[model samples]
Target: MNATQEKHIAVVGGTFDPIHYGHINLGRAALSALHLDEVWFMPSGSNNYRSDMGIRAEKHHREAMVKMAIAGEERFAFSDWECAQPGSTYTSRTFAQLNATFPEVTWYYVVGADTLHSLKYWEEPELICNSVVLLAAGRGEQVTSGELQATAQTLRTNYGADIRFIPWEDMPVSSTQVRARYREGSFAREDLPPGVYDYMTSHHLYQSLEWLSDQEILDRCDATPEERGYYERLATMLTPRRLRHCLGVMHMAMLLADGYRNVSMEQARLAGLLHDCGRTENNALNALGHAPAGAQVARRLFGVKDESVLSAIRWHTTGRPGMTELEKVIFVADYIEPFRGHMLHLDKARRIAYTDLNQAVTFMGESTVRYLESRGEDIDPITLETVNYYRGLLKKQPIPGQYQ
Candidate 1:
């Protein structure tokens, strides 16, 4: 086969709700093994197999994410033809349409080994198998050579399918795992393409209260049923004004985290959102601080088990000495969020946040002290300790860990 003798096109189709690295690896593997000129990512609009799955995003969002995911890959392109169709999407129908459009090229369907096993059950399975050469890739620890050989032999004998198993190291990533982590407030940007991850975060996709209706919100939250219940309760518990403030804090924390590499944006957002969970009419002036109270509520009500996230929420309002990067981000974001409304030097504090995290923390702590003194309110000992500690750092001196 000369380099330009045949026009070989590989087609990788999936729901791709938020395409991860694993999907990209599979397409790359197929392209290399089959010598395909390009890989077309076909994101199905309404998959009959996945129709019962509740976590699917809308067609436009999925399509957008897919585009962002494959932006820089020269050989990768996406088609909206399947998504534009109404009703359940069948692979056979897509293959028919693709063949009609590009009759000169040889189409290879790239899929996982699991999908290969279930291909016979798809609508008009014979038509699908005969239309394109099936290129099945293995998932980590799931597909075996013996099983793959048996399945391919059966398919070839039964339906005259041109099946080939492209062997490569298995990738453990999956969209389900990504969605689960997002709901648990632990999604890492490394699991996805950088552009796709940024798009999801900036748009607040897969978060609680971002969708219409409680059920839709719960569905998109990507948490377990029990965790979803807790989110619902929290939504009702906080006043609308307070909830808006919490959201603002979350966004601010994420923005600040970009400058501080030690802190995770996801953890910062979670801490900022739950920082005021304990503030209510009953506990507005309680002797027990809202920070600690919010930590307790987060543990008991929201099932938060991450120690760093809990600690960040626990000390967001009153900064403790020797705080972690995430703690500093949440503490600063809570003070400087846009909705905080009318504070002296707030603009300076916001500017310092991106330039120097330590300075921002020190500024917020000192401002809090001065504000409390002016109002004749009691000063928290820990707040003073934090201010002094950062001041010591600014002066290049060691301060004893008195508040730890």
Candidate 2:
């Protein structure tokens, strides 16, 4: 409340669905780069960009995640201002209200580099420009100095916008990618803050094989009576971590199957959920020791008589040649799903999964081959066969341990 000393405030707004280290680092960069007094994380309740942001965790979940991630950071804080708005609120409107509430404090808006480019197109860009200085950080998003400078100039020339790009180190992770990784049952421990991942695990965030109550999980997956018994047994038998992985694969497979015409979403769902039914047996022998056994387990134990589901589970590990669409889906889903984020080139594989499912599988195969070769381990004959079959189909050239 010191009228004499000037105070500076900056606001960064987004879904922050599962706020990660990138968001935190940007706030830190802003503080160090712009010499701001404090940075506020404004999580949007429902914005115009909601649909494009992919699946958003519930408003309260997003808020809680942000709060949890920023707990130790003194300069960073969470605000529910936009989330509390009546409807789709604009950045301009937020500033008007912000100024009205804190007239004396000078406010700045920290925009992502891409968002900064389109600032002139936002509602009342002129008023927004006049209200607060714009700060864009290139911590996670890709934008060259030349591009940022050009965009900043355009904003200034067209709308008289005050914008600056702060010094930042690029972080390769994104929330959507993080969510996908979680849904797949894999996450890089480094992507989230210390306690946040644990929180997500305990709360079953991202639908990554969340350890839900038996009935709730069965209901959510639309499990049949027979399927329910198997799921119940699996829930009790498998470790929490393994079960979560299975669920993430199931959710991811269904998601991947949604884009394919030939694949059965139901088959994809079941295959994903039970892909690891024989994981213990698989681990007992070779790396892929469980694939064939998993299919038999699905039939005898789980009662998944649907050959498509069983076959998908069978090939989920070491993919085979002449694999059906459902087989390809489960194989690729197990590789690129959220829980499998640790795999190399996963983002690329995930991106291509929707467009060209076969190509994504090849990419994953190449990565696996490369990784296995690096360790001087014996390559599985089926895995090499699967890679060669898909690679030949796609006309992809040979790589080490591939096409042999």
Candidate 3:
């Protein structure tokens, strides 16, 4: 690399709630795919959500934790960008600040495969893409070139930017799973990255009362037994009808993800199984939203922090204008679950998953939009956007036949 000319810079930011191997793999992949000079591991601080939690460690403590986690990595360096910002930080702002500091360096914002799908929905997502290349890690059945092309077209048409999709097939481990295990008091040192494992053990992270909430839930679920024989028994005990809705959404969402050719079966299944866990009270469906509830459950019970999965569950019921494939999968699956009542076209929609997940998901989205329209329900912005997003793709590359 020339000394005078700036090198490519890839920024990988996360809560590091206890960074793990997956994070390291993502950082390394970004460097190779973006052809960058270095990758920065940025830790967040005092954001709107974290600030409210009152559980995030002090700035120095968190930074020290990050330092400990990345001690031996030569290619990875820590940047306190989110921590330095005065308020809740956004990706666009972070990219701009980093670019201003190193104007000559080409920038790429590294995100998981799920986050990349939902990038269009982020605040000022267009500018963020324009400012830095968007790199994604992992694969599932859901991602397809058509989907990427659709997302690219949306960015170009709406934001005047193009994003490069780097398919990453790295480790499948998730921070959320780690968190869930931690919450349940079952997480071991083996679950973390070598460096992170060392840091957690030395400092004793995730062993507090705050994280033990899920243990109580696990206890309750284990205690309860449903009367239904097998599937019913599993559904009622492992995943309830209401929870089944979330899982069905997840199952369909995974198929949708498969259509995109990026979502993995394993990741989707896990997301499906855990998506509706936050919805504790079935009767309170219209009252307390499920995402926050599910997210709380995930953090306490399941330990999910993939952000993509968390965001999917959080926004499933009231989808915003733009969502990733994973998010759409969870959202649409809830409505189209095989066991759910009052489905618009359950057979048609369900069949689409086996043939063309995109078609199925688009059908689910359109049906959902129409269903809500008929009932005068408040339509989720993202649900509409997801419909439109697919409609745009369907126009560009129509499916062969009506999904069987």
Instruction: Point out the worst 10-residue segment of candidate 1 by lDDT.
Output: 47-56
Mark the regions of model 2 whose C-alpha exceeds 4 Å error after superposition.
47-55, 139-144, 208-404
List, residue by residue over 321-388, the lDDT tens digit for candidate 1: 89999999898888876567688897677767766778888888888888878998877778878888
Q: Which ten residues in a row have the lowest lDDT in candidate 3?
A: 220-229
TM-score of each: 0.50, 0.49, 0.47
How would you encode candidate 3's per-residue C-alpha lDDT over 136-251 as one tens digit per residue? 56554434557756766777678766456665676767766775676577767666655555554443444431232322222211212211121232354343446445434443
Per-residue C-alpha lDDT of model 2 across residues 303-360, encoded as one tens digit per residue? 7789888888888877888888898988887886655647887766777776677787
Residue-level error in angstroms, candidate 2, position 210: 12
CA lDDT, every model vs. true structure? 0.74, 0.74, 0.59
Q: How close to the true structure is residue 243 of candidate 3, measured as C-alpha lDDT?
A: 45
Superposing all C-alpha atoms, what RMSD in Å does each candidate have to the true structure?
18.7, 14.5, 16.9
